[model samples]
Target chain A: MTKELLEGNFAMAEAAVRAGCEAYFGYPITPQTEILEWMSHRMPELKRTFLQAESEVAAINMVYGAACTGTRVMSSSSSPGVSLMMEGLSYIAGTEVPVVLIDVVRGGPGLGNIAPAQSDYNQLNHGGGHGDYHQIVLAPASVQEAIDMTVLAFELAEKYRNIVVVMADGSVGQMMEPAELPEMRPVTRIQGDWPVTGNVGRPPRVLTSIYIDPPAEEVYNHKILNKWYDIQANEIRYKEYYLDDADFVVVGFGTAGRIALTSVRAARAEGIKVGLLRPITTSPFPFSQLDELSKRAQGMLVVEMNTGQMLDDVRLAAKGRLPVEFYGRPGGMMPFPDDILGEIRRLAHTPLTTEGDPRKRWMDRVRTGELMLR
Target chain B: MQTEIVFAGFGGQGALFAGQIMAFTGMDAGLAVTWMPSYGPEMRGGTANCQVIISDEEIGSPLTRTPLAAVIMNLPSLDKFEDRIAPGGVMIVNSSLVNRQPTRTDVDWLMIPAQEIAESLGNRRLLNMVMLGALLQKLPVISIEALEKGLDVHLPERHRKFLKPNIEAIRQGAAFARGELTVEATPGANGHEPEVIPPTSV
Candidate 1:
């Protein structure tokens, strides 16, 4: 059974239904409130727990409680609210509790407006909560992807016994489109793997992000790097749209990826060879495929809603092999598809002989850790 | 491909519903849509607004700095959004609520006394629907037929009977349109039309 018309938030709730998560706990925030609202409305019918916590702080803890009980559980919020949940998330990461967190990112810095912005790329990619850790973050571009990624998020989180985050933005949370609902299972799986349930028959488990002081910095770095590397090898996913024959590859994620796909289609119609390399999982950055495509393409255009955040990743993946260009809008500006096509054309035709602009060069050096923030 | 608009006014004035119906109507037309309402202490008698986007393609930013159009159900709405409409956009004001007209000459202004219209219709609850009607007339992206079809789809199963008059309102609004705005076909492969429908001028 499938429904043709559904809202993005509703679609995510539907994904939650399919995943059979035990609880849906969250606080309301712009662009993201719909998910909580939908769950609240639909939970009763499904006989699931839907609690609107007092604050994001309480909401994340509720998810932690449910997850600790060894049940599939999830929570979500926008940027500010997610920031509040980071402390709890770090704890979840430490204990390796399998819970999914959806960050429907909006603009940032302070109490930024409720609009879609990918400014949190660094936050989720680097594990914004605190301590030495990282969260599995998946970026979804369209409404359908938001739902699809949601099911995959739960699967990955449970498989690794870790925290999985479906990082989206206001656009993904608020948009409505036609989506085919996936099927539901007949068997009600017993969710009893929680770390803190302390059930009589199972061994008692503890969940915490606390780690005593490690003896050396290198030890911690190596330990974390191993996990990140594992994620990189096993989880890296990038979508290539008409990339088999292309002069340029537009690298983007989330909403930008959708726009880039549209651009690729338009460029193909005009006889210009262009394709898009969409990063499905941002934290587990897909560098291998990008490395392979770098030899074939003349240049790479990295588009983002942030200023040169992903451009750094593009450079890392390409290793200075291809000329890289960046086109971005900060705070809350979404680039038009025409602008994306224009960038692709300009970057594809332009030569790579130049060392790029002085400021851009300086910024790249600053970004690469050759320089530090004052 | 998407035009995000915000309709704002007092809580009971049907401001949020105006944007919601537009979203629902757009969805019925096979266009992606989103509706968001502002909720807080300030939202009571203070101010209220709903953000809505009607799009033929995938919507990127759910929020907009400048909406393609705005409907000010009260003085605070106009005062807050009069300067925020995009260049050559439209601002439809409820004359019954706001005495002051649009101070800016950049956006097309429509002064519809919605309270009076609702009174004539024997129900003030229809203010939002009346504003919706005017918007459906002025903004031709989604057809009158589409809006009617959307109301029937969105108005709940048991109360779906209300869709008849709502559909009639749309037709009336369509008949009231003064200028000629042809129905724009879906944009070609470009996904964006450089100049599809004639730009609405102030």
Candidate 2:
């Protein structure tokens, strides 16, 4: 396939279409409105389902309903809109239906400005909705990665009968780059026995989240937990750079991770032995891999677009074996490569320790306006 | 092996489209490219800009703090982006709209009357193409042939009639940068006399 200049949102929408997505339900929001806009015409042209629901809440429930029929269904929105979908997402999880979601995250606790951010790390990875359910989360840093991951999200969602989210920052959704889209596949509906397909040839099937019996609900909860275990065991993925003989390592995911790569390369050029580890799957995070990196590296730095949301997970993975430093830009701000490079230089020169909270130390530097110095 | 360029102007001046053309040309030439626009609650006449990065290696960050080149289409764009160019960078200024000289002495400058050239070419909207031509002539980041091909592939069908004039505008702007064409001294649309800043090389 020839490469085309594609925006991330439009590419993901087209990739979903080619991946046999039969229905799409979404509302419009900045930095991600193109996805919904593209689907509005493309889905209908293909004789597939596309609905511009009254609100994000209604859109997510539409996704839930479509997923119940074992059809490839998806909905995309930014941070606040995704928040509205949380209730519906929890319902889908409880029902154990396969669904895909694209969350082009923007900054905010509420009604934040529209800009690139990774603040939803905990919201998506740590189970935003109630219950002991886990959603498989894939974070892509580039337009090409976004396309590939959108196709993979459908496969992963169905493989585990769980919700799979392709989480990206507003940058990935808004940026344009050259990428080859996948060939169109004919829409195929799942013919599995689990789907509620009219129940004509067998006993009537009931698919609902209502396990009123406490013991039975506990048993179902255990099943969901066990499936998460399988996902964790089989789905951890990450990308590594310059880690073969490094003395220090930097960890980040999504946009933050790619920006750190620029700093890692700069640090390497200056003869500093620094490397980068970018996690692709944020939910099934590469915990064991970080443990191995901890044994070899003297110190670690965790970079993010939020205020140390993923740092806690990195700390758990490092297991206090080495010092961990932190740096972040919260509330719709993105860090330049030079900013991350400054943090790398500090990590190289300063003495290492895990004695204090890394976030506190970072906050102290931020308070003094030291991080802003060139 | 890498060049970061910023296109800045008002919201309706095609700054984003100009940057998109550069990105498309770079990609068609088999280089890694990224184009990111300054998106927000922008009105039609408000400031707008976009950054384009072309690299031989994988791009880490799409946005750049220091651009290697810039196309300043309006006075506000010049005021906002003049100091952000990297040392030894190239800047193509639209002399028709901007009346002052750039304060920086370390970077090269090509002052072309982009609005005048576009007007002579029969469309004021070709101002971006003119400035883009000047940049291509100065920096040679991508070939003019590749740029033409990009337009052929990416230009919307509704505006296909302007393809020839757009190409001509680009050529005229390149000629102006090459010192083959001269812009007459005339008052700008804002009633301020246009400045004739000569092309400078550091």
- Which window of 10 residues has the lowest lDDT sum in candidate 2 chain A? A365-374
The TM-score of predicted model 2 comes to 0.96
Using all chains and alpha carbons, the TM-scores for the candidates as numbered come to 0.74, 0.96
- Candidate 2, residues B1-202: lDDT per residue as tens digits? 7899999877767788899989988998899999998887663447788999999999988987889999998798899999989999999988877877799999999778888888888887898999998899999988887898888887888888979998998899899999999887356454374333322110
Best model per TM-score: 2
**Candidate 2 positional error at B201, Å:** 35
lDDT of 2 by residue, A76-184 (tens): 9999999999999999999999999999999898999899999999999996898879999999999999999999999999999999999998999988999999999
**How much is B129 displaced in model 1, in angstroms?**
4.2
Indicate which candidate wins on DockQ. 2
Over the stretch A139-209, how does candidate 1's per-residue lDDT look in tens digits? 98777788888999988887767788898977777655556677774324335554565558877665555
Cα error, candidate 2, residue A137 (Å): 0.5
lDDT of each candidate versus the true structure: 0.73, 0.90
Q: What is the i-RMS of every prediction?
A: 5.1, 0.7
Backbone clashes counted, model 2: 0
lDDT score, candidate 1, position A125: 86
